[model samples]
Target: MLHRLFILLIAIVGLAACSGGNNFSSGGATDVARSYTLADFSFAAPADLTVSESENYYPFADVVWRGDPRGARVPQIAAMFETAARRSATGLTGDVPVAVQVRLVRFHGVTDRTRYSVGGNYHIVFDMTVRDARTGTVLEPARRVTANLDAPGGSRAVALEQGGQTQKVRVVNFLTEVLLAELS
Candidate 1:
């Protein structure tokens, strides 16, 4: 009976460990050009920015442990950025003549096979550029932003999808901060 109880305890612990937990951390901004406050950085009011998905950007291309297909990658990523941008714009008071361009660089997450073999948290990285639309001058040079995120789930596909969802939120937050920071 003691041996059976021990086995049960071990199983419970194992399951708990396997269950997802957040190990997220913002990787701090890198390759930044210079810092500018809202007062220093001036642009037109009613800010409008454009988000473009690079040719090689593939957030959901490969399938590690396929369940249901994730469908198109570009549209999904574009939509995510668009949605986030709109939310971020709401915080701004006036219009800005800056055009925001983004390219998703890396999106690494766990798969069914790697989840156990490799112990690394999921992460997303992207490059952003804030430019003056009228002058065509680079306000904020291209900089890479990386953030570690919580794992989505246990199953491979579900995890990937969930990871993407979390990534979208991170991207949105990052962009919003950038916009608000420049204004401040």
Candidate 2:
């Protein structure tokens, strides 16, 4: 009976340890730029990982997301921006590529009401630092950037989404464009 109680207590503790934790992943949802955040717009990363240069990382803060779904996550957002950075990297002409260190601050895509009506802005703000891929040298110091774009709305929004220019796609495109201009 005592042995059974001890085993049960161990099992309970193990379960608690596993389920009671949240981890920060290097890659975003689809393995894309790397992650760059949490709910309450707050995120706490797992304590073990160290920020490095060669491995792309986008640190995050308490993100303020309005009109986004509850399922919106930092990993997903980080993945989106990372993917865009990769896309923009293609435009880099030199042998050594550049890295973008982005710390996301705010993002608000079209709300349902705005999407159905006169459209809105995908208000995205972040602090970005550009670095040399080979040397980890800062090409550009951290600068706050606002990468907002017009979100198509009403029938146009729906049509674009149906055609695959979704909120994700548009935002990614906008970010890619932003990075390209910034890098240049």
Candidate 3:
């Protein structure tokens, strides 16, 4: 009876956390994307990502790890970079209201980990490019972006863990914003 009760409790909790939708939609960077689409330029990502999980360690946004059990993954940062590049091309066209296309020229993921004074963590690097959709000209060229995922060094969850996810997401947002600013 105890085992059954435990299973039931876990089921209820998991159901509460599950997302209602299967599709993920990330808005383009407004700063760069005043106008644009994916057909314009080419892109390349980093190599591959391998993420470990911990109850206390979390991402800033509703990011989806390579194999997230929760199924609440957000669009990867590479997509955001490409979107921003498309928007930049739109900006270059003087917001002429033409539909631009972006192509994925390359996509790779590079994983690296580091040990800070506080903890050990990993980051995924993504490299890509964006260009003119119709004319096939390079828009932003190829650039690399990195997203860090940190794991607490200690054994148990600390009070700081409460905001870890929010902070990580904020860092990602800042990175995207900066990239868009530079590309556009």
Order candidates by lDDT, high to low: 2, 1, 3
Q: Candidates' lDDT values, in order?
A: 0.45, 0.55, 0.38
- Global CA lDDT of candidate 1, please? 0.45
Per-model clash counts, in order, read 10, 3, 29
Ranking of all predicted structures according to TM-score, beginning with the best and ending with the worst: 2, 1, 3
For this target, which candidate reaches the highest lDDT against the unseen true structure? 2
* TM-score to native of every candidate shown: 0.46, 0.60, 0.36
lDDT of 2 by residue, 18-126 (tens): 2311111122223223321100112222333232221101212234332325554566667777778778766656544656677766654545554666565565667
Between 1 and 3, whose TM-score is larger? Answer: 1
For 1-184, candidate 3 gives per-residue lDDT tens digits of 9998886576445433332312122233334543334334433432343323323223232223432234322335445545555445444534322333323222211111111123333333444455555666655454544434343333322334355643234334443454444344
- The ten-residue window of minimal lDDT in model 2 covers 35-44
Assess the local accuracy of residue 176 in candidate 1 as a C-alpha lDDT between 0 and 100.
Answer: 58
| Error in Å for residue 119 of model 2 | 1.4
**TM-score of predicted model 1?**
0.46
